[model samples]
Target: MRTRVWDKMIHLPVKYFDEVKTGEMSSRLANDTTQVKNLIANSIPQAFTSILLLVGSIVFML
Candidate 1:
């Protein structure tokens, strides 16, 4: 994903880089990737567990 993001940024217009600082762009890339990693690592399993619990509860109730 970081590679993809870097590829996209590489193709962007020079005008964009002129306006945004390189440090800021790198920081944003790092932060965004970390957030995505955290969401996948933490949120996905929790959601799957919740769904399984709900299905189990409904099955037992019926």
Candidate 2:
């Protein structure tokens, strides 16, 4: 994901680089990728487990 982001950034016109600060871009790259990694690594599995537990409880209750 970081590589893809970097590739996209590299392809952008020089005008964009001139307009945006390097620090801001770096922060955006780091923060956005981290959020995505967290969602995939932590949130998705937790959500799946929660759903499975919910279904199991419902079945056992019935």
Candidate 3:
């Protein structure tokens, strides 16, 4: 990704998947991917569930 950003400045050809899974790759993906998964799994469901309950309450009052 960094190389792609600076591709114009450097003349070396770039290729992906060269370091698909290694120490740096695992470190980068482990924390970020877990956080992303938690956000989607827990926060999103809780938000939608709360909204549904709120709408149900309003409809019941009406």
Residue ranges of candidate 3 with Cα displaced over 4 Å: 1-27
Worst 10 residues of 2 by lDDT: 27-36
User: How do the candidates rank by lDDT, highest first?
Assistant: 2, 1, 3
lDDT of candidates 1 onward, in order: 0.93, 0.96, 0.65
1-62 per-residue lDDT for model 3 (tens digits): 33343453245234433634356555555665668778999999999999999999999999
Better of 2 and 3 by TM-score: 2
lDDT, model 2: 0.96
Model 3: per-residue Cα lDDT at residue 5:
31
Which candidate model has the greater TM-score, 1 or 3? 1
For residue 15, give model 2's deviation from the true position in Å. Answer: 3.1
Write one digit per residue (lDDT tens) for candidate 2, span 1-62.
Answer: 99999999999999999999999999879999999999999999999999999999999999
lDDT of 1 by residue, 1-62 (tens): 88888899999999999999989999878999889989999999999999999999999999
True lDDT of residue 25, candidate 1: 98
Candidate 2 runs further than 4 Å off: none
On the 0 to 100 scale, the lDDT of residue 29 in model 1 is 88
